[model samples]
Target: MERKQFLRTLGTGAAFALTFPCLQGCSKDSDNGDIEEIPSGVDFTIDLNSSEGAKLADNGSFILKNLIVVVKDLNGNFVAASQVCSHESYDQVRFTTNDGGIFYCDVHGSRFDLDGAPLNQVDSTPAKQLKIFNTELDGQILRVFE
Candidate 1:
């Protein structure tokens, strides 16, 4: 599947590994989802909050829409992850660091890197990477593809 479509289906830490095609060996930081063709046409960009009328606070969260997306890590390295958890499939949590400092899972004890590599996990739990979508920023508009 393509990146953008993966985002809607997978969660943050469960995307990367589960999505990469022709991957070498599977590990904790990645998933083993099967390879299927991403639909021919799908628009993954959801303006969670438009920057036009909304004010992006210097230290607050302000998005135009609620359709979550995978933005650039604080370091600007690009990686799109599903906001849900592959382990739990819950959509009520997230991992955010304005400074790109850490990936914190609110529901579970999972924490990962900016690249979704695991930093820690619960005992014997199956590790999964978030589903990632490929993206492009057009001026101020982000064009996400699956």
Candidate 2:
């Protein structure tokens, strides 16, 4: 083939190669429906002396257990909420010191207050409230329950 014809064929083949994978990735059938659900019947405890419990010793610190995000608020209060984000049901929620200690999902910018209420609109719609579990501290053990 001539140089000009070879160059045209190579460019077209390269363009098709790059675009095909992206187009395939955009198909709805490729979605695995992997959205997570808020945990239920979640009764569990953490020992203050254990390594996992030590994470919550500091104010504004948090730990994830049983699909739950347990946090020590800035005021030193223990609170527990589901790690599942209300928007898109992704398990990416965590407590952050930002906005005075709120649960934030990095996946879609979904924010929830300590009370599990949505803080802002996500995806142009009001996101649902996160599941908030009750927390009780007795001696050196913290109990989290639905």
Candidate 3:
């Protein structure tokens, strides 16, 4: 085949190869309910003396355990929320220092306050609130519970 004809065929083939996979991925039946559910009945503890717990000593630092994001707020208070984003149910939520201290989902820019209240709208609708768990610090043990 001529060089121009070969190049034209290659471009069309490449476009077709890229298009079908995206079409299949975007189909309605593609989702098989595999998304993780927000953790419930979540009762766990972290020993502040342990290496993992030591991270909370720094304000604005956070740790992920049992699909939960535990954070020490800027005011030096322990707070916990689900790592699952309420917008898309993706496990990409974490504590951020932005706006003082808030839970942010890296998946779709969903933001929530320390109280788990939605701070922004997603897809033109208000995003759902996060599942905020309770935290109690007894000496060195921090208990996180739903």
Candidate 4:
């Protein structure tokens, strides 16, 4: 390969390694560096039907077990799945993208639908899914428990 092409490929590989540290390339030469992320659990109940839910109706984010919790839409009837990109894991706090279509990873621009389906880019990056918790509405509150 040409110098520029090789460098570009290297950069892409490096970026992929950084984003998904659990991947293969990142496993090599671990003697030089180690990033140990200790997981801590968190719990939160989102109200998807009331003003409080309305207040947090868009791209609302919470953290649990170092896993990002993102809230997309709650139309008082049902809650929309938070569009979390599995590729880049670019979940923001208290903000939702208006696309209402799919979530995009902030790092490599990988896209996943509301159901967490990968749209395009990269064979190494799997077109898998994200977590979708059960939501409930009782009286005036829609609680996403457990």
lDDT of 3 by residue, 90-135 (tens): 8888899989999997666788999999988878866788999999
Against the true structure, what is each candidate's TM-score?
A: 0.50, 0.75, 0.75, 0.44
Candidate 4 structure quality by residue, lDDT tens digits, 87-119: 443342122344654455544556655555566
Give the whole-model CA lDDT for all candidates, comma-separated: 0.49, 0.89, 0.88, 0.46
Could you tell me how far off, in angstroms, the CA of residue 25 lies in candidate 1 after the best superposition? 45
lDDT of 1: 0.49
How good is model 3 by TM-score? 0.75
Model 4: pairs clashing at backbone N, Cα or C within 3 Å: 58-96, 59-95, 59-96
CA lDDT of 107 in candidate 2? 73
| Candidate 1 residue-wise lDDT, 74-131, digit = tens | 5554445455545565542244663354454555666656565666665587677655
lDDT of 4 at 31: 30
Off by over 4 Å in 2: 1-34
Better of 1 and 2 by lDDT: 2
Report the Cα lDDT for residue 30, model 4: 38
